[model samples]
Target chain A: MVKAAQRMYYGKALAKLAERKEIVVLDADLGGSTRTSDFAKVAPERFIQIGIAEQNMIGVASGLAAAGKTVFASTFAVFATGRCWEQIRQAVAYPKLNVKIVATHCGISVGGDGASHQALEDIAIMRALPNMIVISPADANEAYAATMAIADLKGPCYMRMGRADFPLITSEGVKFEIGKAAVLRNGNDVTLIGTGQMVMSCIEAAGILEQNGISAEVINVSTIKPLDSETILASVSKTKCVVTAEEHSIIGGLGSAVAECLSENRPTPQIRVGVKDSFGESGDPGELMKKYGLTTDDVIKAAENVIGKKGKK
Target chain B: MGGAKGLDVKDLRRRADKIRMHVIEMTSEAGSGHPGGSLSSADLFAVLYFHVLRHDPKDPEWEGRDKFVLSKGHVAPVLYAALAESGYFPVDELLTLRKIGSRLQGHPVKGKPPGVEMSTGSLGQGLSMSCGLALAAKLDKKDTRVYCLLGDGELQSGQNWEAMMLASHYDLNNLTIFIDRNHLQIMGSTEKTMSIDPLAYKLRAFGLRVISIDGHDIKKIIKACEKARSSSSPTAIILNTVKGKGVSFMENNADFHGRSCKPDEKEKALKELTERMSSW
Candidate 1:
């Protein structure tokens, strides 16, 4: 029922986007799950139903952008980024086209549909591109704001959203900027930087850490690329220990980006909690997240481990 | 409008001949370049730059200017010659065609080089990009048209069909596609390798206003372009052309697809081009 509510929220967001005449919605045949059906009904003329062709959808969006239309191209994160990577690189990122890619069903949360549906490498692939802003919003509200913000932005961006329902963490009317990080909770002992679905997990973990007398600074890093370097650097400088959580690969996702930033700007003890260089399997979203060490407990454990290492140093 | 017909067809022909000559020289200088496709599309480029397209050579980024995307990008020599002759850059810059630091890369680079709307070499993509540009112009209510040139061999890519379906579905009357149907590719003849036959019919079936003409004949090429501009639907003009139209030895030769002419061969090619120019 909560999942149904989340879908309703996405549908409402799509409806709001459709009301804006410049907003054009494109679907790679996954309009139902993506909740783009609402927008399609409201503005069929603005909606382009590109059937199962991810690469062409990206190119078409890039074309639409050239025509002065703000386009939102949606599909499963796996197919949208992986299948049409070259087109994104050439037509969108290389040309710096103003096209917002709304990639749904990201991470191991895309349950039952299994590893094939889950997108663990979407962040890695999108972040590697030159002029692409990668955003993995935490909840339906963040997704809504991210969609609207990216539309107004002048360059290409990839918005990663989850399939399963995520709890609404941030309150309504909260200002969301493209490159700024949201500091959810403040602490001095250890910094917990998280993105996407993991932001809610980190927030919960920060509460648990508080009970144990560890002041854990929880930062919701929505924008992965053009990262909030100022916030990350300041937090790491004060905390001296950092834990990055994400529903993505440990190799090149938010964790790697944070590690790279810390290693360069400030040398801090860091532990990355994510899907360990492995594929997800068929299971419930919660069970799969826990099994793959992507739960709130994992973030807590990672924070403790990094803090221990920081104390030794 | 009748005065456009009087706008120096002879001078346009001479420019096309010079572009063909430049393609031979540049390809020979680089020791590697596509001369065949370049020669075939020379007249099309001449018409686009000289008379047809509303492009300002001085301000390449003039937003009101019509867009031209060379999908078959290996034929950069022809584009370089035309851009240089049209005063986008100095004529001497043509010699730096494929040099390391040259803005004129082996393929066109958009925004960096004047007159090039999209940077393309990976085939089957230009048509899609052009479709976007045309679709964008339509959305903006701009009267500017988007033109894309594709090689017959490049048609082997599936992306072209995807773009074709979209172009037709949108009824992008502002977009005009020219296929340099020279029938020769790097390996061999297009038919011997992969038949793109009934090409005109296939385009028509995809809901395009299809036209067939001699790609090298300036008169027919110009006429087809004018007809494409007048059509209510997107146009796909198939230019039945020789791989290398000007050079006798290189004509219909697949080896000229990416091979450079030898020093002695360059002299012979230049001499032939000069004689043809004098006669004209």
Candidate 2:
């Protein structure tokens, strides 16, 4: 059975933490859509609904964090990361405050609402900021675990979540740690690195490649800012090739992160499979993913091309 | 040193004059700083650091201490001067404004200065931060109030209005907002550019108790601050001030908004404020 969206699990995590007595959740009037309303139900007094003002919401979250409250500021990814980018930089990131900006409805999976609502560049923008930790969980379970994990970690963080239901990939009690890669499936022909919703596709692509006897290693990169270079380098050094899949832009998303890591340490042949410098259009999420070159088929094809570049049997 | 019930008006005036002189010298030394806005807000800064705020200069992170957010952070020279003069740091450190590796950065950075409460440089964010702080203070059941200073130009940013609504909606009685109505921004007069005229009505409409005051008057500024503390709702004190308060050449001069005074202009400004310092 498919689980709820990552945002649903985020809200559930906060509800579970309601007894902790220090967690304060804020939303930019999009609580219902972002699923932060779940926390509002459990801890109404602790939840602050700042109406339609993303900038003020971020600043207020920073203030609460400064005053010793673990603050979670949530909204749609476009408004949370793009509209209030400067506010996040000035008030939250600069101070290195313990504020988690968990933005939902990220990427083309926020389908039919069109490009204006999709946050294809959040990873790049957030990672560029000093003292900002960017994370994109693979599924609902990881998002839930990441929410709990982020509360314990210090410093400003940007967590991106998607709109649609994600297939359950991780079993219960799978440990979640910031800046660490989870080796989902181990193999040797090529490394399949993915983040957010695309990790499911990378897993499927690895399975298909295994059927073809290509033996693709699958790694889920939940943390984007501090790219898990050690795991990617080790995997790529053994595989000698990589195919990075993400639901964001190919320009600066997980693909670019993997490429940057491999170029410095492993020097492996890499293929970046994502939205290639284009905006998403209104369509079904499945069709949009295929249109944007973020499908499992695309990752499998990228794996073949990259392995071919290695010039190995 | 700040153990007095309230600072005597004359002593506060002398301190304000000294602060104004320091603003001139520091901005002149920096060679590129906002002297006009700093000069305008010097009196209010004087009254706050010396009289109004409940802070320990030594224990800058005192939980019970009242917080101040320089919403109009370009006028950081005045805040820096007050912090130094109040012994939060060395008085001589005022001369190092905007220099490489100086704690006195071009804008008010909270951690760098012992008493600077929030980092502010980008306009229209401090009021929101103030509301957050005030809400927290109320949650902790402390009498600690938050004071945020906003510029006339900064009021144009829509985020300030958003913060205003939040403060009012939350009934953040512990927050006091001061708007420095200096009429001039770097571009030109606020009226010629984006006008914030009839600001009293706008502030009241936004659900704040508005109090108009002569910003340069130490006694009046102090009185309004007292009233803000006693108010049941969050207060917005409108400080009707000249762009450049103490200096003759710079007063109401848009040219002096962000640019530091030239050597001759700096000498003239110091000469005028130095004489007033002796009398006050």
In order, candidate lDDTs are 0.85, 0.89
TM-scores for candidates 1 onward, in order: 0.92, 0.98
Best by lDDT: 2
- Rate residue B127 of model 2 by lDDT: 90
Local accuracy of candidate 2 as per-residue lDDT tens digits, B194-253: 999889999999999999999998889988988988899899999999988888889999
Question: lDDT score, residue A57, model 2?
Answer: 93
List, in order, the clash count of every candidate structure: 2, 0
**Residue B86 displacement (Å), model 1:** 2.3
Model 2 clash tally? 0
Per candidate, native contacts kept equal 0.53, 0.58
Residue pairs with backbone overlap in model 1: A63-B132, A67-B136
Candidate 2 C-alpha lDDT tens digits along A93-129: 9888889999999999899999999989999899889
**Best TM-score among the predictions, by candidate number:** 2
Per-model TM-score of chain B: 0.97, 0.98
List where candidate 2 sits over 4 angstroms from the true fold: A311-313, B1-3
